[model samples]
Target: MSRRSSRRSPAITSTSPCPCGLGETLGETLGECCGPLHAGSTTAATAERLMRSRYSAFAVADEAYLLRTWHPSTRPARVELDPAVRWTRLEVLGSTGGGALHAEGTVEFRAHLTDAGRADVLHERSRFTRVDGQWVYLDAL
Candidate 1:
Protein backbone atom coordinates (compact mmCIF):
# COMPACT_ATOMS: atom_id res chain seq x y z
CA MET A 1 0.00 0.00 0.00
CA SER A 2 1.01 3.60 -0.53
CA ARG A 3 2.06 5.67 2.49
CA ARG A 4 -1.28 7.50 2.55
CA SER A 5 -3.32 4.30 2.54
CA SER A 6 -1.15 2.55 5.12
CA ARG A 7 -2.52 4.58 8.01
CA ARG A 8 -6.07 4.88 9.26
CA SER A 9 -7.13 8.28 10.48
CA PRO A 10 -10.09 9.18 12.60
CA ALA A 11 -12.12 11.90 10.96
CA ILE A 12 -13.68 14.01 13.71
CA THR A 13 -14.81 14.12 17.28
CA SER A 14 -17.84 15.89 18.67
CA THR A 15 -15.50 18.19 20.54
CA SER A 16 -12.95 18.73 17.82
CA PRO A 17 -12.86 22.21 16.34
CA CYS A 18 -14.36 22.45 12.86
CA PRO A 19 -11.84 21.89 10.09
CA CYS A 20 -13.31 24.57 7.86
CA GLY A 21 -12.00 27.39 10.06
CA LEU A 22 -15.50 28.27 11.17
CA GLY A 23 -15.86 29.83 14.59
CA GLU A 24 -12.18 30.68 14.35
CA THR A 25 -12.65 32.80 17.45
CA LEU A 26 -15.57 31.14 19.31
CA GLY A 27 -14.16 27.72 18.46
CA GLU A 28 -16.97 25.72 16.88
CA THR A 29 -16.74 21.95 16.97
CA LEU A 30 -17.49 19.70 14.08
CA GLY A 31 -20.45 18.24 15.94
CA GLU A 32 -21.94 21.69 16.40
CA CYS A 33 -21.09 22.79 12.89
CA CYS A 34 -20.75 20.63 9.79
CA GLY A 35 -21.41 17.37 11.56
CA PRO A 36 -25.14 17.91 11.36
CA LEU A 37 -24.94 18.61 7.66
CA HIS A 38 -22.79 15.56 7.17
CA ALA A 39 -25.27 13.44 9.06
CA GLY A 40 -28.22 14.64 6.99
CA SER A 41 -29.79 16.00 10.13
CA THR A 42 -29.68 19.51 8.73
CA THR A 43 -29.14 21.41 5.53
CA ALA A 44 -27.19 24.55 4.85
CA ALA A 45 -29.36 27.67 4.82
CA THR A 46 -26.95 29.60 2.65
CA ALA A 47 -24.56 28.86 -0.15
CA GLU A 48 -21.59 29.96 1.90
CA ARG A 49 -22.52 27.53 4.64
CA LEU A 50 -22.76 24.75 2.08
CA MET A 51 -19.36 25.75 0.80
CA ARG A 52 -17.92 25.50 4.29
CA SER A 53 -19.55 22.15 4.91
CA ARG A 54 -18.20 20.87 1.61
CA TYR A 55 -14.70 21.91 2.62
CA SER A 56 -15.13 20.23 5.95
CA ALA A 57 -16.29 17.06 4.23
CA PHE A 58 -13.14 17.05 2.11
CA ALA A 59 -11.01 17.49 5.20
CA VAL A 60 -12.68 14.51 6.78
CA ALA A 61 -12.82 12.41 3.62
CA ASP A 62 -16.59 12.07 3.69
CA GLU A 63 -17.01 11.09 0.07
CA ALA A 64 -20.63 10.15 0.48
CA TYR A 65 -21.53 13.53 1.84
CA LEU A 66 -19.67 15.21 -1.00
CA LEU A 67 -21.48 13.24 -3.67
CA ARG A 68 -24.84 13.62 -1.98
CA THR A 69 -24.50 17.37 -1.81
CA TRP A 70 -23.40 17.67 -5.42
CA HIS A 71 -25.96 18.81 -7.98
CA PRO A 72 -27.13 15.95 -10.13
CA SER A 73 -26.70 17.92 -13.30
CA THR A 74 -22.98 18.14 -12.70
CA ARG A 75 -22.38 15.27 -10.32
CA PRO A 76 -20.20 12.41 -11.41
CA ALA A 77 -20.99 8.72 -11.15
CA ARG A 78 -18.56 8.47 -8.26
CA VAL A 79 -16.10 10.57 -6.36
CA GLU A 80 -12.77 8.88 -5.71
CA LEU A 81 -11.10 10.64 -2.84
CA ASP A 82 -7.36 10.27 -2.70
CA PRO A 83 -6.06 9.23 0.69
CA ALA A 84 -2.87 11.03 -0.22
CA VAL A 85 -4.61 14.39 -0.20
CA ARG A 86 -5.03 15.92 3.23
CA TRP A 87 -7.28 18.95 3.21
CA THR A 88 -5.97 21.46 5.71
CA ARG A 89 -7.72 24.83 5.72
CA LEU A 90 -10.45 26.86 4.08
CA GLU A 91 -10.71 30.57 3.40
CA VAL A 92 -14.01 31.95 2.16
CA LEU A 93 -13.14 34.94 0.02
CA GLY A 94 -16.56 36.19 -1.12
CA SER A 95 -20.07 35.24 -2.16
CA THR A 96 -22.94 36.29 -4.40
CA GLY A 97 -26.63 35.39 -4.18
CA GLY A 98 -27.19 31.83 -2.82
CA GLY A 99 -29.42 33.02 -0.06
CA ALA A 100 -32.63 31.42 1.17
CA LEU A 101 -34.57 33.48 -1.34
CA HIS A 102 -32.28 32.72 -4.23
CA ALA A 103 -32.09 29.51 -6.24
CA GLU A 104 -28.48 30.02 -7.33
CA GLY A 105 -25.34 31.34 -5.68
CA THR A 106 -21.59 31.41 -5.93
CA VAL A 107 -18.86 31.28 -3.31
CA GLU A 108 -15.20 31.97 -3.78
CA PHE A 109 -12.67 30.24 -1.56
CA ARG A 110 -9.18 28.93 -1.14
CA ALA A 111 -8.89 25.32 -0.02
CA HIS A 112 -5.42 24.45 1.29
CA LEU A 113 -4.13 20.91 1.40
CA THR A 114 -1.07 18.71 1.54
CA ASP A 115 -0.74 16.13 -1.23
CA ALA A 116 1.91 13.44 -1.10
CA GLY A 117 4.08 15.69 1.07
CA ARG A 118 3.56 18.74 -1.10
CA ALA A 119 1.54 21.73 0.06
CA ASP A 120 -0.84 23.31 -2.41
CA VAL A 121 -4.07 25.26 -2.64
CA LEU A 122 -7.17 25.01 -4.80
CA HIS A 123 -8.72 28.41 -5.41
CA GLU A 124 -11.98 28.83 -7.19
CA ARG A 125 -15.36 30.48 -7.31
CA SER A 126 -17.87 27.66 -7.03
CA ARG A 127 -21.50 27.66 -8.04
CA PHE A 128 -24.40 26.23 -6.08
CA THR A 129 -28.06 25.56 -6.75
CA ARG A 130 -31.08 24.55 -4.79
CA VAL A 131 -32.53 21.20 -5.81
CA ASP A 132 -35.74 20.26 -4.07
CA GLY A 133 -35.01 23.07 -1.63
CA GLN A 134 -31.61 21.69 -0.69
CA TRP A 135 -28.33 23.33 -1.46
CA VAL A 136 -26.05 21.38 -3.79
CA TYR A 137 -22.73 22.05 -5.45
CA LEU A 138 -22.93 22.78 -9.17
CA ASP A 139 -19.49 23.57 -10.52
CA ALA A 140 -16.47 25.85 -10.30
CA LEU A 141 -16.06 29.10 -12.15
Candidate 2:
Protein backbone atom coordinates (compact mmCIF):
# COMPACT_ATOMS: atom_id res chain seq x y z
CA MET A 1 0.00 0.00 0.00
CA SER A 2 1.12 3.54 -0.65
CA ARG A 3 1.83 6.04 2.10
CA ARG A 4 -1.39 7.86 1.33
CA SER A 5 -3.43 4.70 1.64
CA SER A 6 -1.57 3.52 4.71
CA ARG A 7 -2.24 6.72 6.54
CA ARG A 8 -5.49 6.47 8.46
CA SER A 9 -8.10 9.14 7.98
CA PRO A 10 -9.73 10.73 11.00
CA ALA A 11 -12.44 8.45 12.28
CA ILE A 12 -15.90 9.68 11.41
CA THR A 13 -19.26 7.95 11.08
CA SER A 14 -21.73 7.70 8.26
CA THR A 15 -24.22 9.78 10.20
CA SER A 16 -21.75 12.40 11.26
CA PRO A 17 -22.09 15.81 9.73
CA CYS A 18 -19.44 16.57 7.14
CA PRO A 19 -16.78 19.02 8.18
CA CYS A 20 -17.16 20.82 4.88
CA GLY A 21 -20.54 22.05 6.18
CA LEU A 22 -22.40 20.37 3.36
CA GLY A 23 -24.31 18.10 5.70
CA GLU A 24 -26.81 20.68 6.73
CA THR A 25 -26.99 22.43 3.42
CA LEU A 26 -27.01 19.40 1.14
CA GLY A 27 -27.96 16.61 3.52
CA GLU A 28 -24.84 14.64 2.81
CA THR A 29 -23.01 12.94 5.65
CA LEU A 30 -19.28 12.44 5.86
CA GLY A 31 -19.57 8.95 4.42
CA GLU A 32 -21.85 10.01 1.60
CA CYS A 33 -19.82 13.10 0.72
CA CYS A 34 -16.11 13.76 1.04
CA GLY A 35 -15.18 10.34 2.39
CA PRO A 36 -15.10 8.58 -0.97
CA LEU A 37 -13.21 11.46 -2.53
CA HIS A 38 -10.52 11.35 0.15
CA ALA A 39 -10.36 7.58 -0.01
CA GLY A 40 -9.60 7.75 -3.72
CA SER A 41 -12.64 5.67 -4.52
CA THR A 42 -14.07 8.57 -6.52
CA THR A 43 -12.96 11.80 -8.09
CA ALA A 44 -14.71 15.13 -7.93
CA ALA A 45 -17.05 15.68 -10.85
CA THR A 46 -17.02 19.46 -10.52
CA ALA A 47 -14.67 22.16 -9.32
CA GLU A 48 -16.96 23.08 -6.43
CA ARG A 49 -16.95 19.48 -5.22
CA LEU A 50 -13.16 19.48 -5.35
CA MET A 51 -13.05 22.73 -3.41
CA ARG A 52 -15.41 21.49 -0.74
CA SER A 53 -13.55 18.19 -0.40
CA ARG A 54 -10.30 20.11 0.05
CA TYR A 55 -11.88 22.08 2.87
CA SER A 56 -13.01 18.83 4.45
CA ALA A 57 -9.49 17.48 4.12
CA PHE A 58 -8.16 20.47 6.00
CA ALA A 59 -10.75 20.02 8.71
CA VAL A 60 -9.74 16.38 9.12
CA ALA A 61 -6.00 17.02 8.62
CA ASP A 62 -5.78 14.72 5.64
CA GLU A 63 -2.74 16.17 3.91
CA ALA A 64 -2.67 13.25 1.51
CA TYR A 65 -6.03 14.15 0.10
CA LEU A 66 -5.06 17.81 -0.14
CA LEU A 67 -1.91 17.03 -2.08
CA ARG A 68 -3.67 14.49 -4.24
CA THR A 69 -6.29 17.02 -5.34
CA TRP A 70 -3.69 19.71 -6.09
CA HIS A 71 -2.41 20.18 -9.59
CA PRO A 72 1.06 18.65 -9.82
CA SER A 73 2.58 21.80 -11.28
CA THR A 74 1.79 23.69 -8.09
CA ARG A 75 1.50 20.89 -5.57
CA PRO A 76 3.81 21.30 -2.61
CA ALA A 77 6.35 18.75 -1.42
CA ARG A 78 4.23 18.32 1.63
CA VAL A 79 1.36 19.93 3.49
CA GLU A 80 1.45 20.84 7.16
CA LEU A 81 -1.79 21.96 8.70
CA ASP A 82 -1.65 23.67 12.09
CA PRO A 83 -3.05 21.28 14.66
CA ALA A 84 -4.03 24.17 16.87
CA VAL A 85 -6.35 25.62 14.28
CA ARG A 86 -9.66 23.80 14.01
CA TRP A 87 -11.44 24.21 10.72
CA THR A 88 -15.01 24.85 11.75
CA ARG A 89 -16.99 25.92 8.74
CA LEU A 90 -16.86 26.56 5.01
CA GLU A 91 -18.78 29.25 3.17
CA VAL A 92 -18.58 28.95 -0.58
CA LEU A 93 -19.34 32.47 -1.66
CA GLY A 94 -19.44 31.93 -5.42
CA SER A 95 -17.98 30.14 -8.41
CA THR A 96 -17.60 30.62 -12.15
CA GLY A 97 -16.92 28.39 -15.14
CA GLY A 98 -16.40 25.29 -12.99
CA GLY A 99 -19.17 23.29 -14.50
CA ALA A 100 -18.81 19.74 -15.85
CA LEU A 101 -18.30 21.19 -19.32
CA HIS A 102 -15.63 23.73 -18.32
CA ALA A 103 -11.92 23.04 -18.33
CA GLU A 104 -11.11 25.72 -15.75
CA GLY A 105 -12.99 27.34 -12.90
CA THR A 106 -12.72 29.41 -9.75
CA VAL A 107 -14.32 29.13 -6.34
CA GLU A 108 -14.53 31.99 -3.86
CA PHE A 109 -14.86 30.88 -0.26
CA ARG A 110 -14.47 31.81 3.37
CA ALA A 111 -13.05 29.15 5.67
CA HIS A 112 -13.73 29.77 9.33
CA LEU A 113 -11.37 28.41 11.95
CA THR A 114 -10.52 28.81 15.61
CA ASP A 115 -7.01 28.84 16.96
CA ALA A 116 -6.50 29.05 20.72
CA GLY A 117 -10.11 30.12 21.08
CA ARG A 118 -9.67 33.00 18.63
CA ALA A 119 -11.81 32.78 15.52
CA ASP A 120 -10.61 33.87 12.10
CA VAL A 121 -11.62 33.57 8.49
CA LEU A 122 -9.49 32.87 5.47
CA HIS A 123 -11.25 34.25 2.45
CA GLU A 124 -9.89 33.35 -0.94
CA ARG A 125 -10.81 32.84 -4.57
CA SER A 126 -9.11 29.65 -5.72
CA ARG A 127 -8.55 28.40 -9.21
CA PHE A 128 -9.05 24.88 -10.57
CA THR A 129 -8.44 23.07 -13.82
CA ARG A 130 -8.75 19.66 -15.42
CA VAL A 131 -5.71 17.47 -15.86
CA ASP A 132 -6.40 14.19 -17.62
CA GLY A 133 -10.09 14.94 -17.15
CA GLN A 134 -9.75 15.14 -13.38
CA TRP A 135 -10.40 18.37 -11.54
CA VAL A 136 -7.48 19.63 -9.51
CA TYR A 137 -6.84 22.77 -7.54
CA LEU A 138 -4.39 25.13 -9.25
CA ASP A 139 -3.92 28.21 -7.06
CA ALA A 140 -5.54 31.00 -5.16
CA LEU A 141 -6.38 34.32 -6.80
Instruction: Give each model a TM-score.
Output: 0.90, 0.89
**Can you write out model 1's per-residue Cα lDDT over 10-109, one digit (the tens) per residue?**
7556577888788455577888888899889999999999999989888777777888999998998876678788888898999999999999999999
The 10-residue segment with the lowest total lDDT in model 2: 1-10
lDDT of each: 0.85, 0.86
Query: Residue 30: error of model 1 in Å?
Result: 0.7
Backbone clashes (count) for model 2: 0
Candidate 2 regions with alpha-carbon error over 4 angstroms: 1-14
What TM-score would you give candidate 1 relative to the actual structure?
0.90
| Local accuracy of candidate 2 as per-residue lDDT tens digits, 53-129 | 99988877778888899999999898877667778889999999989999999999999989988999999999999
Best by TM-score: 1
Q: Over 4 Å off in model 1, which ranges?
A: 1-11
Error of 1 at 38 (Å): 0.1
- Cα TM-score of candidate 2: 0.89
